[model samples]
Every structure is written in C-alpha cells, then in structure tokens.
Target: MRVEMEFLGSGTSSGIPTIGCDCRVCHSANPRNKRLRSSILFRVGEGEDERRLLVDVTPDVRMQALRANLSSVHGVLITHTHADHCHGLDDLRGLYWGGGRERLQLFAYPESLAQLRRAFGYLFDEDYDYKGIARFDTHVFEHEPFVVAGVAVTPIPVVHGNMRVAGFRVGDCAYITDTNEVPDTSIAKLKGVRLLILDALRRAPHPTHLSLGKALHIAQQVGVERVFFTHINHDLEHDQINAELPAWARLGHDMLRVAIEADGRISTDEGGGGVAPLAF
Candidate 1:
C-alpha cells in the first residue's frame, strides 16, 4: 500500500514568528519560515479504503485542516499531551458535526492518555449530556505494534528529558518528535525506515529537544533514505539552514506533502520524475 504524508505544522511549541518576538527568521520573507505547531496527517491505502490518520491535534489543527481541505479524520495518534501537540482536542467536535456520531479512534501512551483525560475531562465524559463534546474510542499502547484503521502502527519509545514519549512507524515512514534521545532499542525498530521525520529544534542544544547537530547524527546513524526535520525554532532561518543541509535532509515546512511506497520509495512535489532535494 502507498501512504501519503502531509506536514500540517512543523514549528516548535511556541511556533515560528512567535508572539511579540522580532528575530531575523521571524521577520524573514520566506513562506517556509512561517510555521504552525508540530503535527502531521497520514493517508493510508487508496480510494474508499483510504483512512486518514492524524499524528497530533495541535492548537492550529482547525486552520491546518481548513488549509489542507481536510474533511474527515478517522483516527488520531498522539505523541504526547503537550499543549501544542494535543490542545486542539476540542476542535474535533467540528469533525463530528455532519458525520453522525461515529466515534474517532484515539491512540496514545497510557501517561499521555491520562494527561489528556485530565486536561479535557468534559470531552471524555460519557454521561456529561453535552451536545458538542468530541467523541472518541480511546486505546492505549506502549512499545508495541498495533493496528489502527487497518494500518499497522509500531510505537517507538523515546526520552524527552524526564518524560517518556512515543514515536510512530507506519508503512515505510517513521515520525518522531519532541525528543532529545532515541535509545538503541528504539533505533533498532527504525533500522530500515526510508523516510524519517525527526525533531530538530535548533542549532543550540536543548535539554529535552534534539539539537540540529544531534538530529543530523541520528539521521546518519539510522541511514534513512530521506530526513525531514520538524519541531523547529526561530533560531534557524528556513532558507539559510536548509541551504546548508545535504540533499538527503532538509527542514520540514507546514503543508509539505510526500508520497511513500510500500517498498520505501519516497517522492515529493519538489522532486519531480526522480528523487530531488528536499525543499518547500
């Protein structure tokens, strides 16, 4: 099966062009410099059998969905319960507006799920009698493989400071974010992935987020065919930083879309005919 992935938002928690901050990258003219909170959309299978799986429910999910022409989201795979990553849980009520009462499937780690339920108790309340609360069928998984909407998903355990989060692998692509380190066991799970979307906050080292240098090293160690860095900060200018990266790796931007085949081949709009440099 062929899987299509769309980068809904690629910015860090604060997002690019951050509030009231006047930095060079924040004031840059490049459209790629503008980013929303980190999130991604995955379309698996084809035709009617195709299922839309969202990676995170960022605060910008409403606008992101509208911009991407998203109609329905079948499931959501959360990385963690950070405000930037899952605060948009409320907006999912809109998706259930016209589609009847079909409950959406939500997959996450136990800790993350508990955080979400605590944060959004109203949405999960079965007897709240609320008319517009987002409805979901929640499922929890640790470092194991499970099926979601017929697509197999493997959770990759990663460490983000003192917190443990999950990254997911679907088909030939793996999406990992908000992490400073990937243990050897997790690296083994990602050994042969063709496409990797990783967290690369900035050039400077962070206690919880992967620095650009560390992200690059991880990409090289994994030896993936393509790498797109996400969870970016304002310290790096899109054009300048991207220009410095090798052809196999580049900074990921919102709205960027790529197609991956079952055999691990990847193609993007910027790459016509053959594999081209990662841009846009």
Candidate 2:
C-alpha cells in the first residue's frame, strides 16, 4: 500500500504575501512564495477506490480543495482548533452535497473537539433544524492510536505554548504542526519515521511554534529519511530557506505531493507550476 500526500497549503496563519507588507519574500517572483494557510490531503488506496483524508481545514480550505482538484474527503484529522486551522468546517457542506452524501469522519483531541463544538455550535445543534449544514461523525481520541478508513493513526501529543495539540503518524509518514515542544514521549513515538511534515514557523524563536532550528533538531533526532517544513511565515523565502537546509530537509510549498511507499521509501513530485521538488 502507498500513501500519497499533498500539501494543500503551506503558509502560516497570516499566509504568504501577507496583506500590507512589502518584504522581499512577499514580493519575490517565485511562485513557491505564494502560499495559503497550512493543510494537507492524504490519499490512500488507488484509482477510483482511493480514500481522501484531510489534515486541518483551514480558512483557505475551499480554495485549497479547488486548487488541488479535491472532489471529496472521507475523513479529517484536526491538529487543533485555532481559527486558522478549523474555521473552514462550514465549507465541508459543499463536499457533502456534491460528492459524498455520507457524513464525514472527524478525528480530533478532546480539547480541540470541545473548542470546535463551541465555535460551530449551529452544526452540532440537532434542534436547530437548519438544512444545508455541514455534518460530521465526530470521533474524539486522546494520545493514543486509532483506526480510520482502515489505516492506523497514532496521535502524538505535543505542547503548543500552554495548550496541547495532536500530531498524527500514519504508516511511515507523520504530520505535525502548531507545536513548539515535542516531549520525550512524543519523540519516542516518532522514532524511525520515513517522512516527516513538521512545523517550522520562521528563523526566529516563537513561544508557541517551532523555529527552523528547533524543527531541524527534531527532524535529526527522529532520523527521518525525508523531511518537509510547513506552517511557514513570510519571514523565510522558499528558495532562500531551502538553500540553508540539509539535503534531507526543505521548505514545503503549496501543491507539493509526496508518495510514501509501503517499504518506507518516499518520492516527491512537486507541483508543476515551476516549483522544484524539495530534495529527498
């Protein structure tokens, strides 16, 4: 079995080319510099029988889906409930109506789930009786492993400043974001990961997000075969930051796709809009 992953968006909360900024990276001619809020799509199985799993429904998810040609999503794995990460829940209604009529499965930590319910009360309100609302079969899990769509998913717990968030490990690949601290236990869980998609906010240190140095340390500690940094801010230009990284690591961009083989080998096919594949 192979798991194909796509970087639907790879920008920080503010996104690249941020509003009212005249920085070099924002004005760079490179298409890779243009980004949306962080999100990823995981495709398992093959051909018409494939199952699409989304990680983080950002406010840009609707546009992300359209850009990626995503027709339907079978499940969603939420890292946290931050406005940038989960505010696009309402957009799932279009997928429900146009593609899969069945309810989508949503996996999240208890804290994230609580926050989501609070933020989107109308969706969870059975008595509201509103039609055309997005629906999900919510499943709450802790820092444990669970199965979704026949794939084993292990939730790695990490600290995002004062709050706890989840990083998911499925097969040979792991996707982690919005985290500053990866405890020893979580590090142990990430051991031997073949492909790692991690949060690398910027060059400077942050209270709630991992800096480029911290992200590289974690990637080296885990000994991942290939690593891509996500949740990037405008401070780092795609080409400039990638030039500083080791051959095994690079800055991820929107629409970059990675193929994870069953034998733990990984290959990348960058989005064809002139962005090269981050060296494996």
**Cα shift from native, residue 226, model 1 (Å):** 0.3
Off by over 4 Å in 2: 271-280
For 1-280, candidate 1 gives per-residue lDDT tens digits of: 8888788899999988899888988887677888889999988987888888999999988888877778687888999988999999999877666347688889999999999999999899998997877799999998779998789999999999999889988877889999999999999999988888999999999999999999999998888988999999999898789889999998888888877966656877643221112232
Score candidate 2 by lDDT.
0.86
Tens digits of per-residue lDDT for model 2, 139-196: 9999679988887889999999989989988777889999999999999999978899
Model 2's TM-score against the true structure: 0.94
lDDT, each prediction: 0.87, 0.86
Off by over 4 Å in 1: 262-264, 271-280
* Worst window of 10 by summed lDDT in candidate 2: 271-280
Model 1 gets an lDDT of 0.87
Q: Candidate 2, 143: how far from true, in Å? A: 2.0
Candidate 1 C-alpha error for residue 55, in Å? 0.7
